[model samples]
Target: MQVAILDDWEDAAARFLAWNDLPASVDVTVFRDHVPDEQELVERLRPFDAVMVMRERTPLPAEVLTRLPNLRLLVSSGGRNASIDMDAATQQGVAVCSVPSPRMSDSVAELTFGLMLSLARGIPQQERGLRSGEWGGTVGISLSGKTIGLLGLGKIGGRVASIAQVFGMRVLAWSERLTDERAEEAGARRVGLEECVRESDFVSIHLRLSDRTKGLLGASLLGLMKPTAYLVNTSRAPIIDTSALADALAERRIAGAALDVFETEPIPTDDPLLALDSGTVLTPHVGYVLDTTYEDFFTGYGEILRAWVEGSPIDALNPEALSRGPGDVRDGDEDRE
Candidate 1:
């Protein structure tokens, strides 16, 4: 079986997994760079029977899936990936599997605070200045007595709320399905979205990207924020309008924004956000890029591949595809579980 691991940009896969330990018949190939073009991606993956994707780095839509006639097994690092077209994979008889994500919430929640603190105290800017023989000239804000508005109170948001209370900050939360009981459980008060944005000193977004949330924080909503307030988003990028945010930052509408995710990965050199001054702190989507997290992901990858090659596919998102049988290479092999 020919296996291709896509988007191992840090070259951590080989460090975590022993590729040579696989059956002598299996040939593994790893691609470190990203291929944005659909035709080019299709051409590159056309020869592989199995493909392992890191998160949403490479989107395999129906068009791309249909072009890869040899692709049989698709493995992703996390339990769920919004980028993949699962229905299309099922139709194509592709067995889609996901590895268990250990401590995903903890890693992302930690980064959320990392960005929040950096913005509050201008840590990154000060560090650079000190390295260049400069001293502190910026005034930092304390989290104590400040109000923090949480856009979503899911696992990660709940964690953030608890930590905010430790810093003596008031937590106000808002979401479509958030209840008063749920908010209280997380040490937060349930409030309307507008009130949450307008009243808080810090606004952190933890909402999932969907039809309802896409461009949810547009000009009108962002206009409600106090000029003294700061924004932090470690979640999906499309949830907020990129152009509107750039304009807000450029015009100094909000104090600043610390973003760990963007509309495009490895944001372009000419991206407007890059032109902004010290008010913004941008990171290359490293929310879940911890060492322990990668260890769990690549370790699970090895286990799943071994199981599939042994005629038993595990942790399949679309089990219906298994009913149709494995891809062309292992057509007659019966799936044990």
Candidate 2:
């Protein structure tokens, strides 16, 4: 069976996992470049029996699904990929499966600190000044005794809150469902969303992307934040309005913003937010791409592929595949009725 692994940027797939151990019957091909247009993606995916996709990078829209009629199975790197059209793939008789997510708390939590420290101490500006032969660089703030606000008390947020305490920063937290007890347990005090943003020295977001959270951080919500406070989002990007965030950063309403995810993956070069030097840190949606985690993701995809070819499929997200009677394998082997 021909399996095409799409969006394997940097060609890290072959080196990271046990691809060579895959059954000789399965021919795996990993493509690094992204196929952005639906027509292009459809064309590229049409010949493959299975395609592995990264989370939310190349959107498998309904249009794209309609064109790839030859596709039988789809695998996403992360267990929960919002990019794939689950309903559409199901209707098209595609078995969608996901790999297990790796333990990735400390990596993101540590990176969040880097963004906060850079913002607080004007690290970027100072570096530029020193490179340009200026001495005093820029004034910066100390983290000790500062108010740190966390917007979610989940695994990643909980770790971040603990680290904030170690830095002598008083931690506060809030979310749509954040409990005071959960906050207290994480060594954080829970507060109203507005209060957390308005009074925080470093406002970090850790909310998930759901109907309740989509566009939750808009102009009004951001307008409530203290002008000196910095906003950090290692979480999903759609949580904040792209336009509104650009406006806030351009105007310096908030000190600076650190973003790991954007509403649109591969943020456009013309994006207005890119123009601002004083108030932004941008990462390519890499809050979860540590080497250790990538190893787990690649290995998980290998398992999913093996189960599909072996007749009894496992982790079938498009659950209907289990009920389909055994079909002929593409390598000219006919199924015994």
Candidate 3:
């Protein structure tokens, strides 16, 4: 079976999985760089019988899925991947599998606070200045007595709320699914979205990207924020309008903003967000990119591949695909049957 691992940008898959230990029948190929063009991606992936993808790095829409005639099994790093077209995969008789990482939420939560603290104290700027033979020139604000508004109170957001209490900060949460009782249990007060934005000293977004959330926070919502308030987004980038944010920061309407994820994975060098003089801390989307998380993902992927080769797929997200038969394996191989 020919297997392709897509988007191993750090080349960490080889270190995490023992490819040689897999059945000798499996031929594994790893692609380290990203291919953004659909035709290029389709041409490159056309030969593989199976493909394993990292979290949403390369979208496998119907346009790409229909082109890969040999593809049988598709494994993703997390329990859910919004990027993949499930309907398309199902219609194509492609079995989709998910590798669940229990540690992902905690890892992202840690980065959320890292960005918040960096913005609050201007840590990155001060560190650069000190390296250039300059002393501390900026005053930092304390987290204590500040009000933090959480956009979503899911596992990661809940963890952030608990940590905020440790810093003596008040937590206000808002989401379509969040209830006052749930907020109370999480030590947060449930409020409307506009109210949360207007009242927060620090607004941190943890909502998933979806049709409803895309462009949710535009100029009007952002204008409601106090000029001293700061914004931090560790979630999907489109949740907030990028152009509106750039305008807000450039005009000094808000104190600053810190982001771990962007609309583009490796933000363009000429992106306006990079040239801003206001307080801004940016990271290359390292929220769930921990050593432990990678180990979990790659290990699960290896197991899934081994099981599929044995003619019994496991951890399938779309069970309907199984009825189509154990996908396009080597013909006339008695062991495969």
Give lDDT: candidate 1, residue 147. Answer: 97
lDDT for each candidate structure: 0.88, 0.81, 0.88
Root mean square deviation (Cα) for candidate 1: 4.6
Residue-by-residue lDDT tens digits, candidate 2, 161-272: 9999999999998886778788889999989988988889888888778888888789998998888888998888888897898899888898889888876778888877
TM-score, candidate 3, is 0.93
* Number of colliding residue pairs in model 3: 0
- List the candidates' TM-scores in order: 0.94, 0.91, 0.93
lDDT of 2: 0.81
Q: Candidate 1: minimum summed lDDT over ten consecutive residues — where?
A: 328-337
Local distance difference test, candidate 3: 0.88
Local accuracy of candidate 3 as per-residue lDDT tens digits, 125-218: 9999999999976899999999999999988889899999999999999999898898998899999999999999999998988888899889
Candidate 2's displacement at residue 321, Å, is 3.6
